[model samples]
Target: MDSSAGHTPEPGSPDEPVVVLGVVAAPGQAIGLARKLVEADLTDHIQTTFPGARWQLELLEAGVVQPPAGDAEIVDATRDLLLEHEWDLVLCLTDLPLHVGKRPVVAHANAVHGVAVLSVPALGATGVRQRARGIITGLVGQLLGADADDLREHQKSPARSALRHRVRQLGTDVDEAGTAFTARVLTGNLRLLTGMVRANRPWRLALGLSRALTGAIAAGVFALVTADIWLLADTFGGIRLTGVALGSIIAITATLIIGADLWERGSSRQTREQVALFNIVTVITVVLGVAAFYAALFVLSAIGALCLVVPQVFGATLDHPAGFTDYLEVAWLTCSLATVGGALGAGLETDEAVRDAAYTQHPAEPI
Candidate 1:
């Protein structure tokens, strides 16, 4: 289960290997600590194999609580062996805070590598998720550059594994990862390497398209109400209309939006500033949309004054059929419907929207 030792020298480092030493100073971040060093292409400071460039890897592990003997003493013991073995670089991985302090080990590593040490902090839960996503996306973009379909093949290869350890930290139950695993395997056959970039477009366009379609439908509904109601009022008895359902719809719409925002933000989100900002932005969008539409509707209603009233029992003379009341009613109704419609679209097609929102900025900086 500990694929830890499997990274042993292949065909064995006969002549000399690029030496790497990893110290999983923290308890939980060992998995990431391991790969961050070995997967150089995933994270840092290693030369990719090119013309006349050979990369042979050698890795060692130690612990923060009990480092492998004194730094000076170990370096001394290994100095002769390293010269004999010919190591190009010596890498030390640790998560201990003191390791970065004006400590001696870091100084020693600096002396060895000719520059300051290259280090990655202990990836806590949040860091783990972000780093893992970065690795996957980076790998998807860089090596084995495949479309959506080729992901499985990429996964099976070294390119896919560029960030596997960090990915393992996502805490997806091993059981649930089964589906993801299978999906990856099948992905190689479709959406070839080039397709991932094409498929993973941003949220604005997708959401904008959906919004336009829904807006067209809502407009259709509003037009029907106007035509039917106007004809009925002229034929029978015309009554000034107050949309009775407006308030109830507003309350329902608000509840759904606030509830969904709460759920998405999660209990870990304690700061209210961000939520308030989002709400303010959303309210502004709604107000603008409503105000524009209602103003236009009111103008049309003023034009409606030219028509005759039918079934004249309800003698309500009007300066305009569409009054301030109609503007208020339409504005309220438009916002409620828009909110509900937006929420439904977001919830129903969550896979796409969520993926888009999360990955809007492509390829996070690696480690």
Candidate 2:
């Protein structure tokens, strides 16, 4: 066997057969190779000139290779045919630069039947596809030995494994970007992405992010609800006031980001979109929150209860500074449960995130 440029021709044995799996570069590649070997019997082809398209078609018209039927996606058809065709060996002639190794055939043969594979730079359709089939079978058989590792363990091998690991890292990078953006505003846990980060990070970023998001959300909601009935249109309880909830949300975000930055310098994020969205949601949440309380009153008032606050959108001022101060105090209290106000009024209830995160798994894991 000349393993230099290629394998030597097999000695003729009518009874014994060679099992081959082919991987051609594309549809044209497969067609050309099959034509060369079949119609033209041009068995000795190594590399050919960039001959005109006429030369390309002469082979296809010769019926040496097969083209897929109408309306079928090429890659899928290849797999279906490969799996359906029963033979000692599988020959793949791909015109597309796709993978035979990626096929279920290869996976089944190696992972199940313990086959292995052989690879060589393709010369013709038959040889290239044959070698791919052989190599896959060979690998499967080798891995199927007594000390065999499961597909998962074997996949951790250095050469191929790094690619897998890098893909996972890329996924994590996207996730990290998302978390950082979300943490600065609105309310949603970023823990979804933290699982794939290196250990200990899951604790710091995931847990911390969840808290910040919840605080921001709570503050936004409180602001939206209370701002309407706050006091007088722009005033609080009809008196001038500071924006307490807004301040609390900002304080929490700043403190969290700053703390993280102090510990893991330059690692924290500040995104304007996130902050802007948070602000918008805060404005809306305040309106909704106030309305919601009124709604609660309207519903309870039906049953006769004291939960009713005035349902009016505007009213006489209590006094600008005092009203504003009161609103600010409410905002501040909205952001802090364990800090300023008692635990009942601030942040989100515990059940919200726990309920959402239920059954959620790390995105990178394989089925």
- For 1-367, candidate 2 gives per-residue lDDT tens digits of 0011232222243321222222222344445545445344222221011110111111112121244421112322332333333211222333322223233122222111112221122333455544443343333222222112323443455234322222122112112345554453233212212211211122222232355344444543443355443443243432322344344334433343233221111122222222233233323323233223323322322222112222233123333333333433444333332221111232332432321211111111111
lDDT (Cα) of model 1? 0.32
Best-fitting candidate, measured by TM-score?
A: 1
How much is the lDDT of residue 153 in candidate 1?
42
- TM-scores vs. true structure, each candidate: 0.26, 0.20
Candidate 1: tens digits of C-alpha lDDT, residues 1-367: 1112234323223422222222222343544555564565533322221111223345444442344433322333333333333333333334433132234221223221111122234334456544643443332232222323333443465334422321211111122233453343234212221232332232233243354336434643453245344443334321223232244234323433453342222122111211222233333333333334333434443333233222131223222455444433434343434434444443443332332232222221232
lDDT of 2 at 185: 25
Q: Model 2 TM-score?
A: 0.20
| Off by more than 4 A, model 2 | 1-246, 258-263, 266-306, 310-364
Candidate 1: where are CA atoms >4 Å away? 1-216, 223-347, 351-359, 365-367
| Global Cα RMSD, each model | 20.9, 22.3
